[model samples]
Target chain A: MIHFLLKGVLHDRHRSLLPLIVITLGVALTVLGHAWVNGVLGESFVMSAHFSTGHLKAMTRAYAEEQDQMPIDLALIGVKEIMDELAGIGEVDWAPRIRFGGLIDFPDESGSTRSQGPATGFAVDLLTPGSKEIDRFNLTSSILSGHIPTREEEALITYDFAEKFHIQPGDRFTFFGSTMEGSMAFGNFIVAGTVRFGAEALDHGAILIDLTAGQRMLGMPDAAGEILGFFNNNRYDQKEAQAIADSFNARRSGSTDEFAPLMVTMRDQEGMAQLFDYTHIISAILITAFVLAMSVVLWNTGLIGGLRRYGEFGVRLALGEEKSHIYRTLIYEALLIGLIGSVIGTVVGLALALYLQVVGLDMGDAMRASTMMMPSVIRTQVTATDFWIGFIPGLFSMTLGNALSGLGIYKRSTAHLFKELEA
Target chain B: MENKQIIDINNLVKRFPIGDGYFTALQGITLRFVAGEFAGLVGPSGSGKTTLLNLIGSLDSPSEGSVVVLGHEVSRLSHRESAALRNYHIGFIFQTYNLLPVFSVYDNVEFPLLLQKRDAVGRRKAVMEALDWVGLSHKAQSRPAQLSGGECQRVSIARAMVKRPELVLADEPSANLDAKNSHHIIQTMKRLNRELGTTFLFATHDEKVMGYLDRIISLDDGRVARDERPLCVNEAQSDSTAEENGHARRQARI
Candidate 1:
């Protein structure tokens, strides 16, 4: 029986090839869609974990609220002592960050004295000695190009900003801002080697400067926003960290009224978490649509062809073939079709995913700047799991379509042979 | 347990609904055929020969009577049981040789064996022998479409005999064949019957088929009109009858 069914399918190979191809491609696409979403999320998570936050992060609520406040300035004098105290505790690894927001002026290269828009700058203590957090955060390479700031003046601008302003390793740039004493202040720093992080938003706007200089420039002396910590293992209790933060807040009872509210800990970095959530929703919608469309296509192709084979079924029945045998044979044919289609589709989809990973999707520069808040080149990362994930939807669609078609074939009455033959 | 009757029909009747009314296809047909008999059912179109064949073949149930084939009450059988009984015990040859298009000639012949529990080696031997008997062993590997109409009919005959059934019912077996193919198919079937002692019942309208039958049952308006033994009895019986008639004629002359 199986032999006959197989021979029948092969005999009609020409007729079945079109549907098989269509079904296989559909399955592959389904797999690819799932893989794409997973790859994007997984890659983003790894980048965020490596460059911004480890598995867990701790920061003051005040630093989280006031984006411009330097975390080192908000730190109490005893904050480092407390951090050291916590560091000795089991699995506690701390990295203190001094965050500051400033602006980068892209010098006009047209010889015109026209003012250009200021690119946003973010300064962090990325090169502290023996700091595992800083080491992890430096995803690309060393922070500054020429050297670490011997004085509180040197800065490292992002690759995007440096490219925009034609700044190099030895070039000096002046920064002017109000001091903490309400007096005008200015300084100059040598340009450092630029670091390239793949993320468009990070590459385009961020600049690194000396934490002490940022503290002085922000006019927050001996005050810091919050201390950032990464645990060796993500076993530290958020409640415990919050409790310590609250105690610090209590000790600073007479602080300025404008002091930002302090927070304790968060799991994921802010930018990464937002991007992941957004992409997840989009991926889900795309996958659902793709699956639905593929299922419909498969159903249409399989069922229509199956129904058309009724005359053949009738003839078999007339020759004393059992209806069960007929049903089994048709289902076997469908299974073969599904198997072939799924294999082809999986291969095609995986290849497409790999290609996409290699040569990333580049939205034009203006659109990239407007939508992504980063550079134009955004490459998708391919993962092994992505291929497997992409393969499933296609395989499922093929099976489902073929099963439904088989049912339609089974529903046909064998007694119709007389009338069918007469026609 | 050694019964002679191969088919037993008791007041079998068949009616079909046409539009809002009923059309009687067969009106109380009661007939029987013993084993090893070659019988022909002759009728014009719409004359109930097919209805009677359908009932006897267990393809359909009688409206109001019993049809027993090979000691089993066919009307009482379930659809699956009927199909099984037909596959194992009764061989059916249709007006159009219904060979599966996907199957080769040998596979088509071996189709009935698949329903049984025969192993592949046994099935192959049986199919090869049947095809040999039909003189189509050379065309065994050819598909049905590749064969001529006559050759296809021969393949169907092989399929029917491969199961070694007790009764073979051929419904207009040569309806689609040329005269030559029809004669060849009839000769092949007759040979099979003689060699295997399988009872054959044919429902056909062909006059050319009448000359080849051992018995003819003419049907008209859903009833048997004439049941005649067209073949001579044994030579012994014929000689005795001739002697008795000659002596009576001499006495009359005296």
Candidate 2:
């Protein structure tokens, strides 16, 4: 019976063609839209994680509250113990970093300052063997000129800062800042390289130095302002990060010291919680709207198709077919159309998504003036959900449309049909 | 013909609504037919011949009185029961040939057997036999749209006869055909009646159809005005015989 109905549908272009095309296009748009949204939001989260937030971060309670101020006075002490303890949490790579403010003075052939500017600096474990900081900061690709620091007393400065100060690689500069204990701090460093991190805020006046140099120059040994913990998989796991933070905080719950250590997940900082929540809500609303709109269009299509087949329905009914049977076949026909259309749409949508994923749109000009830590080129991320997202609207809208249109079959009287036929 | 009664109508009345009032299409119609009788309800338009046929076929119920077809009261049967009666025991042929335009001639003919859930081999044989009976076996794969009017009607007849139903109700079977095609269609039905022993009842005013029926019940203004058998009779004698036969059949049914 199904085979017979299938043959009928295949042979009759007037019945199935328009509905199939509508379904295919609707589903394709849905799949591509979903993938595009996931891609943009996913990329944003990953960039923020790598540059500003790690999967997790640990700092003193007072420093966390005043974190935006880069308060080195409230920094974590005895970082070796914290690093050892964090290693037991899960698959994580822990790194210590110090965010500092200092003055960099370019020196002439003499030992006196030629020019000076205030700068923001990140002191990382650059000299440590097998350190992941180089990869984490993506410094190799961002180098505009020169090389990264290869020895003590060496540092990397931003391309913009170098261009502004007319400082070149292999030149010497004096760094002057206050120590954690509120005393004077001073150092002289050779400019090893110049780099650009792409983001306007970071590339403006940034400098990078070895963690050991930072500790010595700031009169603090075996200490860091903050420690970042990144997942080994290079993807953020919210639940695992939250679990670790909760457990770490619980262990120190009794400590009333203002300087006691605390842990925070990436979402706890930078308003990420609200951003991700909005993405989820938007995705749900997008799919629902698509389904409703497509259903209405397909419903009208089915209504017209049903009206055209009124005579055929009467003939089937007169031949001893129950009204329910005819209605059931309509639904079965819709199901077959939905399945075929969805497969085709998914293939088309996924192909477009894969292309965008490989060759992302470059927004270098758009991001030049932006102070946010967002990447210039944005690409799509196709998740498992994208593979089946189209089928929801495809199958449901087609079935619902045909089911509503088929109600007319029950209202027709076979007697009246026969009378009309006789006439 | 067998003496077993296949359809017994008792004072049947059918009314259709028009605007605010009712238009009576069949009023106080009483009739009966035995198995294997080739019969027709003869009348002009609005005379209710098609209405009476519809009642007998269980496609409709009487507004008053009863229509008992194959021992089941038409008014008392549920939709499923009526459909089952039609599927298993009855067949219908329409004036329009009403073949599904998308289906080929063979599939249209095989439709009833498919409803009966016959096996593939049986269905194929039954459909082919019905097609062969109508001399359309060679055009089994052709769709209804591809066939001429006469060929389309033959396909309709084959479909109606394919199930070997106990009763076949045809409404204006030759109304859309030319005289030559009409005669050919009526002849095909008559031959199927003789060969299959199926009770054939037609609702038609066409003289070509009347010439082939063994029994004719003529209706006028929704009432049975004449009932007779044997085509070549004197007008006065046929009228007198129709009255006597109708009265005798009503008495026998009571």
Worst 10 residues of 1 chain A by lDDT: A111-120
TM-score of chain A of each: 0.73, 0.82
The DockQ score of candidate 2 comes to 0.46
lDDT tens digits by residue: candidate 1, A141-206 = 534345544455666666767767767776666665545455654556666557655566567656
Give the per-residue lDDT digits (tens) of candidate 2, residues B46-66: 899878878887888889999
Instruction: Quote the lDDT for A344 in model 1.
Output: 80
lDDT of 2 by residue, A1-423 (tens): 877898888988877777788778877787788877777777777777776678899999999998887889999999999998998998989888998998888987877779999999889989888999988778898887889888879999998899999989999998989999988889889999999875667878989999999999987687889899899999888899999999999999999999999999998876778876886788678756765676676666666776667678777777888878888998888888888888888888888888889887777677778877676677777888878878877777677767777776777677865544444
Each candidate's interface RMSD, rounded to one decimal? Answer: 2.3, 1.6
* DockQ metric for all predictions: 0.32, 0.46
Instruction: Name the top lDDT candidate.
Output: 2
Give the clash count for each candidate. 20, 1
- Model 2 chain A poorest 10 in a row by lDDT: A414-423
